[model samples]
Target: MTKVFRLKDLDCANCAAKMEHCLNKIDAINHVSVNFLTQKMVIEADENEFETVMQEVVKVCKKIEPDCKIIM
Candidate 1:
């Protein structure tokens, strides 16, 4: 399953890159991209585990940028 989410207050390109790298490390996530310029995120994961994968995505993003929000 693939979903696109708007990002709020994503601080920098470096953070976006870090978020992309970390999110892609998840076993359940097939792919992920964080675009700082566009303030958007695209995630691809197993349909059955999409919700759960998003929860992890949020956590990982927060760790990198505390004020950043992934608009569901």
Candidate 2:
């Protein structure tokens, strides 16, 4: 399944790129995008594992940018 989320406090384009890079490394993720300009994120993953993948995504995002939030 595919999902789009709004991001809060995403500081810079570089950070957004970092988030995208990390998220794409996850095995379950098929595609991911982090857009600093729009403050949004898009993720495509297996439907069955999406929730678990998102939990990991949140952790990854937090590690990179503590103040960043992905609105569920």
Candidate 3:
């Protein structure tokens, strides 16, 4: 399954890379792509792990940028 999220406060390339890196660290996340230019993040993972992945994503995103949001 895949999900697209709209993230805020993505003002730099480094922020985008950090978001990608944090999401990639989750074992349930099979893939992650962040478009800094568009302030979007696409995540791919197993259906069974969707909830878990999203939860982790929220936590990671808050850690990286508290102002960011996952546009579920």
Which structure is stronger by TM-score: 1 or 3? Answer: 1
Model 3 misplaced regions, further than 4 Å: none
Per-model TM-score, in order, reads 0.97, 0.97, 0.89
Residue pairs with clashing backbones, model 2 = none
Cα lDDT of all candidates, in order?
0.94, 0.96, 0.87
The candidate, 2 or 3, that scores higher on lDDT is: 2
Supply every candidate's count of residue pairs whose N, Cα or C atoms clash at under 3 angstroms. 0, 0, 0
Over 1-72, each residue of candidate 3 has an lDDT whose tens digit, in order, gives: 988888777777887899899889899999999889989999999999899889998999888878777777
How would you encode candidate 2's per-residue C-alpha lDDT over 23-61 as one tens digit per residue?
Answer: 999999999999999999999999999999999999999
Give the per-residue lDDT digits (tens) of candidate 1, residues 12-67: 99999999999999999999989999999999999999999989999999999999
Total backbone collisions, model 3: 0
Best by lDDT: 2
The lDDT, on a scale of 0 to 1, for candidate 2 is 0.96
Error of 1 at 24 (Å): 0.6
